[model samples]
Target: MVATTGRGRQGRGRQKIEMKPIQKETARQVCFSKRCAGVFKKASELSVLCGAEIAVLAFSPSSKPFSYGHPSVESILERFFGSSADAAPATPPRHPPAAVLIQALGRQEKELQERLEAGKRRKAALEESLRGPQWGPVGDLLGAWRS
Candidate 1:
Protein backbone atom coordinates (compact mmCIF):
# COMPACT_ATOMS: atom_id res chain seq x y z
CA MET A 1 0.00 0.00 0.00
CA VAL A 2 1.13 3.52 -0.77
CA ALA A 3 1.34 5.86 2.23
CA THR A 4 0.77 9.58 1.98
CA THR A 5 1.47 12.35 4.46
CA GLY A 6 -1.59 14.47 5.00
CA ARG A 7 -2.08 17.84 3.35
CA GLY A 8 -2.48 21.36 4.90
CA ARG A 9 -0.72 23.28 7.68
CA GLN A 10 -2.32 21.49 10.65
CA GLY A 11 -1.03 18.00 11.51
CA ARG A 12 0.96 16.01 14.08
CA GLY A 13 4.70 16.59 14.71
CA ARG A 14 6.67 19.88 14.73
CA GLN A 15 6.58 22.28 11.73
CA LYS A 16 9.85 21.01 10.32
CA ILE A 17 8.13 20.74 6.93
CA GLU A 18 6.17 23.75 5.69
CA MET A 19 2.87 22.80 4.06
CA LYS A 20 2.69 25.35 1.26
CA PRO A 21 0.60 24.74 -1.88
CA ILE A 22 3.70 24.41 -4.10
CA GLN A 23 5.38 22.12 -1.59
CA LYS A 24 2.24 20.05 -1.27
CA GLU A 25 1.98 19.62 -5.04
CA THR A 26 5.64 18.65 -5.27
CA ALA A 27 5.34 16.14 -2.44
CA ARG A 28 2.19 14.65 -3.98
CA GLN A 29 3.85 14.19 -7.35
CA VAL A 30 6.91 12.64 -5.79
CA CYS A 31 4.81 10.30 -3.71
CA PHE A 32 2.82 9.27 -6.72
CA SER A 33 5.94 8.41 -8.74
CA LYS A 34 7.44 6.46 -5.87
CA ARG A 35 4.24 4.56 -5.24
CA CYS A 36 3.81 3.72 -8.90
CA ALA A 37 7.30 2.28 -9.07
CA GLY A 38 6.78 0.39 -5.81
CA VAL A 39 3.55 -1.13 -7.06
CA PHE A 40 5.14 -2.33 -10.29
CA LYS A 41 8.08 -3.78 -8.38
CA LYS A 42 5.76 -5.59 -5.99
CA ALA A 43 3.75 -6.98 -8.87
CA SER A 44 6.86 -8.28 -10.62
CA GLU A 45 8.15 -9.79 -7.38
CA LEU A 46 4.84 -11.47 -6.66
CA SER A 47 4.74 -13.06 -10.10
CA VAL A 48 8.29 -14.38 -9.73
CA LEU A 49 8.10 -15.48 -6.09
CA CYS A 50 4.77 -17.27 -6.34
CA GLY A 51 5.10 -18.61 -9.93
CA ALA A 52 1.92 -16.75 -10.80
CA GLU A 53 1.49 -14.80 -14.00
CA ILE A 54 0.74 -11.12 -13.46
CA ALA A 55 0.36 -7.94 -15.47
CA VAL A 56 0.57 -4.41 -14.07
CA LEU A 57 -0.48 -1.33 -15.97
CA ALA A 58 0.02 2.11 -14.45
CA PHE A 59 -0.70 5.54 -15.85
CA SER A 60 1.61 8.30 -14.80
CA PRO A 61 0.44 11.71 -13.55
CA SER A 62 1.16 12.91 -17.08
CA SER A 63 -1.13 10.25 -18.58
CA LYS A 64 1.80 8.16 -19.81
CA PRO A 65 1.54 4.37 -19.81
CA PHE A 66 3.78 1.94 -17.93
CA SER A 67 3.48 -1.80 -17.64
CA TYR A 68 5.27 -4.86 -16.27
CA GLY A 69 4.45 -8.52 -16.69
CA HIS A 70 5.81 -11.99 -16.18
CA PRO A 71 6.24 -14.18 -19.28
CA SER A 72 4.65 -11.46 -21.41
CA VAL A 73 1.60 -9.31 -20.75
CA GLU A 74 -0.41 -10.86 -23.58
CA SER A 75 -0.17 -14.34 -22.04
CA ILE A 76 -1.09 -13.01 -18.62
CA LEU A 77 -4.13 -11.26 -20.03
CA GLU A 78 -5.08 -14.31 -22.10
CA ARG A 79 -4.94 -16.46 -18.98
CA PHE A 80 -7.10 -14.03 -17.05
CA PHE A 81 -9.67 -13.42 -19.79
CA GLY A 82 -10.17 -17.01 -21.05
CA SER A 83 -8.29 -16.39 -24.28
CA SER A 84 -5.69 -19.08 -23.65
CA ALA A 85 -6.55 -22.48 -25.08
CA ASP A 86 -4.44 -24.31 -22.48
CA ALA A 87 -5.94 -22.46 -19.54
CA ALA A 88 -7.75 -24.70 -17.07
CA PRO A 89 -11.48 -24.57 -16.61
CA ALA A 90 -12.16 -21.84 -14.08
CA THR A 91 -15.93 -22.04 -13.75
CA PRO A 92 -18.51 -24.79 -13.46
CA PRO A 93 -21.03 -25.32 -16.23
CA ARG A 94 -24.34 -23.53 -15.80
CA HIS A 95 -27.72 -25.13 -16.44
CA PRO A 96 -29.22 -23.49 -19.47
CA PRO A 97 -32.96 -23.09 -20.13
CA ALA A 98 -34.59 -26.03 -21.80
CA ALA A 99 -36.19 -23.80 -24.40
CA VAL A 100 -32.81 -22.37 -25.35
CA LEU A 101 -31.27 -25.83 -25.56
CA ILE A 102 -34.13 -27.06 -27.69
CA GLN A 103 -33.81 -24.08 -30.02
CA ALA A 104 -30.06 -24.67 -30.40
CA LEU A 105 -30.57 -28.37 -31.03
CA GLY A 106 -33.24 -27.61 -33.58
CA ARG A 107 -30.91 -25.28 -35.42
CA GLN A 108 -28.17 -27.93 -35.37
CA GLU A 109 -30.58 -30.54 -36.69
CA LYS A 110 -31.68 -28.28 -39.52
CA GLU A 111 -28.05 -27.66 -40.47
CA LEU A 112 -27.27 -31.37 -40.45
CA GLN A 113 -30.37 -32.12 -42.52
CA GLU A 114 -29.36 -29.55 -45.11
CA ARG A 115 -25.84 -30.99 -45.29
CA LEU A 116 -27.22 -34.50 -45.71
CA GLU A 117 -29.51 -33.39 -48.51
CA ALA A 118 -26.64 -31.61 -50.26
CA GLY A 119 -24.45 -34.69 -49.95
CA LYS A 120 -27.23 -36.89 -51.39
CA ARG A 121 -27.68 -34.52 -54.32
CA ARG A 122 -23.93 -34.50 -54.98
CA LYS A 123 -23.79 -38.30 -54.89
CA ALA A 124 -26.77 -38.62 -57.23
CA ALA A 125 -25.24 -36.13 -59.68
CA LEU A 126 -21.93 -38.01 -59.61
CA GLU A 127 -23.65 -41.36 -60.17
CA GLU A 128 -25.81 -39.96 -62.98
CA SER A 129 -22.75 -38.50 -64.74
CA LEU A 130 -20.90 -41.80 -64.49
CA ARG A 131 -23.90 -43.60 -66.04
CA GLY A 132 -24.78 -40.96 -68.68
CA PRO A 133 -24.01 -40.29 -72.42
CA GLN A 134 -20.51 -38.96 -71.59
CA TRP A 135 -19.42 -42.55 -70.95
CA GLY A 136 -20.82 -43.79 -74.33
CA PRO A 137 -17.68 -43.04 -76.44
CA VAL A 138 -15.39 -44.89 -74.01
CA GLY A 139 -17.86 -47.75 -73.69
CA ASP A 140 -18.17 -48.09 -77.50
CA LEU A 141 -14.35 -48.26 -77.94
CA LEU A 142 -14.07 -50.88 -75.21
CA GLY A 143 -16.99 -52.84 -76.69
CA ALA A 144 -15.35 -52.89 -80.12
CA TRP A 145 -12.20 -54.48 -78.61
CA ARG A 146 -14.37 -57.06 -76.79
CA SER A 147 -16.18 -57.91 -80.05
Candidate 2:
Protein backbone atom coordinates (compact mmCIF):
# COMPACT_ATOMS: atom_id res chain seq x y z
CA MET A 1 0.00 0.00 0.00
CA VAL A 2 1.23 3.52 -0.84
CA ALA A 3 1.63 5.82 2.14
CA THR A 4 -0.16 9.17 1.87
CA THR A 5 -0.51 12.05 4.34
CA GLY A 6 -3.02 14.85 4.46
CA ARG A 7 -0.53 17.17 2.77
CA GLY A 8 0.37 14.54 0.09
CA ARG A 9 3.26 12.08 -0.31
CA GLN A 10 5.84 14.81 0.07
CA GLY A 11 4.68 17.82 2.07
CA ARG A 12 4.83 21.26 0.39
CA GLY A 13 8.19 21.38 -1.32
CA ARG A 14 10.04 24.67 -0.90
CA GLN A 15 7.84 27.65 -0.03
CA LYS A 16 8.80 31.30 -0.53
CA ILE A 17 9.80 32.75 2.82
CA GLU A 18 8.57 36.21 3.68
CA MET A 19 11.35 38.76 3.75
CA LYS A 20 11.16 40.46 7.16
CA PRO A 21 12.68 40.45 10.57
CA ILE A 22 12.49 37.29 12.61
CA GLN A 23 11.14 38.07 16.09
CA LYS A 24 12.77 35.21 17.99
CA GLU A 25 16.42 35.78 18.96
CA THR A 26 17.52 32.15 18.50
CA ALA A 27 15.75 31.84 15.14
CA ARG A 28 17.21 35.13 13.97
CA GLN A 29 20.70 34.04 14.93
CA VAL A 30 20.24 30.74 13.11
CA CYS A 31 18.97 32.54 10.04
CA PHE A 32 21.83 34.97 10.19
CA SER A 33 24.39 32.14 10.31
CA LYS A 34 22.75 30.31 7.40
CA ARG A 35 22.43 33.45 5.29
CA CYS A 36 26.01 34.47 5.97
CA ALA A 37 27.19 31.01 4.85
CA GLY A 38 25.13 31.29 1.66
CA VAL A 39 26.50 34.76 0.94
CA PHE A 40 30.05 33.54 1.46
CA LYS A 41 29.43 30.58 -0.88
CA LYS A 42 28.15 32.90 -3.61
CA ALA A 43 31.10 35.22 -3.12
CA SER A 44 33.48 32.26 -3.48
CA GLU A 45 31.72 31.13 -6.66
CA LEU A 46 31.87 34.64 -8.11
CA SER A 47 35.56 34.87 -7.35
CA VAL A 48 36.34 31.47 -8.95
CA LEU A 49 34.06 31.83 -11.99
CA CYS A 50 34.64 35.49 -12.90
CA GLY A 51 38.02 36.11 -11.26
CA ALA A 52 36.33 38.84 -9.26
CA GLU A 53 37.78 40.17 -6.02
CA ILE A 54 35.10 40.58 -3.37
CA ALA A 55 35.03 41.42 0.29
CA VAL A 56 31.90 41.05 2.41
CA LEU A 57 31.47 42.52 5.88
CA ALA A 58 28.37 41.71 7.90
CA PHE A 59 27.29 42.47 11.44
CA SER A 60 24.81 40.26 13.20
CA PRO A 61 21.90 41.50 15.32
CA SER A 62 24.15 41.18 18.37
CA SER A 63 26.74 43.45 16.72
CA LYS A 64 29.27 40.69 16.03
CA PRO A 65 31.08 41.03 12.70
CA PHE A 66 31.28 38.48 9.86
CA SER A 67 33.58 38.87 6.89
CA TYR A 68 34.37 37.21 3.56
CA GLY A 69 36.90 37.99 0.86
CA HIS A 70 38.48 36.60 -2.29
CA PRO A 71 42.21 36.25 -1.73
CA SER A 72 42.20 37.84 1.73
CA VAL A 73 40.13 40.57 3.36
CA GLU A 74 43.26 42.28 4.60
CA SER A 75 44.83 42.32 1.12
CA ILE A 76 41.66 43.56 -0.55
CA LEU A 77 41.19 46.16 2.15
CA GLU A 78 44.82 47.21 1.87
CA ARG A 79 44.56 47.56 -1.87
CA PHE A 80 41.39 49.57 -1.50
CA PHE A 81 42.63 51.84 1.27
CA GLY A 82 46.22 52.00 0.07
CA SER A 83 45.13 53.16 -3.34
CA SER A 84 43.28 56.07 -1.74
CA ALA A 85 45.98 57.23 0.64
CA ASP A 86 48.00 60.34 -0.29
CA ALA A 87 51.34 58.55 0.19
CA ALA A 88 50.23 55.55 -1.85
CA PRO A 89 51.11 55.23 -5.52
CA ALA A 90 48.78 56.75 -8.09
CA THR A 91 48.25 53.25 -9.54
CA PRO A 92 48.52 49.82 -7.98
CA PRO A 93 51.17 47.57 -9.50
CA ARG A 94 50.02 45.63 -12.53
CA HIS A 95 52.34 42.69 -11.89
CA PRO A 96 53.95 40.75 -9.06
CA PRO A 97 57.01 42.16 -7.25
CA ALA A 98 60.04 42.51 -9.51
CA ALA A 99 62.17 40.12 -7.46
CA VAL A 100 59.49 37.42 -7.54
CA LEU A 101 59.00 37.86 -11.29
CA ILE A 102 62.76 37.70 -11.87
CA GLN A 103 63.06 34.49 -9.81
CA ALA A 104 60.18 32.83 -11.69
CA LEU A 105 61.65 33.86 -15.05
CA GLY A 106 65.04 32.53 -14.00
CA ARG A 107 63.56 29.14 -13.03
CA GLN A 108 61.69 28.92 -16.35
CA GLU A 109 64.84 29.83 -18.26
CA LYS A 110 66.84 27.16 -16.46
CA GLU A 111 64.16 24.52 -17.15
CA LEU A 112 64.11 25.47 -20.86
CA GLN A 113 67.89 25.32 -21.02
CA GLU A 114 67.87 21.86 -19.41
CA ARG A 115 65.26 20.68 -21.92
CA LEU A 116 67.39 22.05 -24.78
CA GLU A 117 70.48 20.27 -23.54
CA ALA A 118 68.56 16.99 -23.04
CA GLY A 119 67.16 17.24 -26.57
CA LYS A 120 70.65 17.90 -27.95
CA ARG A 121 72.01 14.87 -26.07
CA ARG A 122 69.15 12.70 -27.41
CA LYS A 123 69.79 13.87 -30.96
CA ALA A 124 73.52 13.15 -30.60
CA ALA A 125 72.85 9.64 -29.26
CA LEU A 126 70.34 8.90 -32.05
CA GLU A 127 72.80 10.14 -34.68
CA GLU A 128 75.53 8.01 -33.13
CA SER A 129 73.25 4.94 -33.22
CA LEU A 130 72.27 5.60 -36.85
CA ARG A 131 75.98 5.82 -37.81
CA GLY A 132 76.47 2.12 -36.81
CA PRO A 133 77.72 -0.27 -39.60
CA GLN A 134 74.26 -1.92 -39.93
CA TRP A 135 72.25 1.32 -40.38
CA GLY A 136 74.29 3.70 -42.59
CA PRO A 137 72.51 7.16 -43.00
CA VAL A 138 68.74 7.75 -42.56
CA GLY A 139 68.35 8.49 -46.31
CA ASP A 140 70.12 5.21 -47.28
CA LEU A 141 68.03 3.23 -44.76
CA LEU A 142 64.79 4.64 -46.25
CA GLY A 143 66.06 3.94 -49.79
CA ALA A 144 66.96 0.34 -48.92
CA TRP A 145 63.59 -0.18 -47.23
CA ARG A 146 61.66 1.14 -50.24
CA SER A 147 63.62 -1.18 -52.58
Task: Compare the candidates by lDDT and give the number of the best one.
Answer: 2
Backbone clash total for model 2 is: 0
lDDT tens digits, residue span 69-95, model 2:
877787778777884565653335445
C-alpha lDDT (0 to 100) for residue 27 of candidate 1 = 70
Regions more than 4 Å wrong, model 2: 1-12, 84-147
Any idea how many clashes model 1 has? Answer: 0
Query: Candidates' TM-scores?
Result: 0.38, 0.50
Q: Give the clashing residue pairs of candidate 2, or none.
A: none
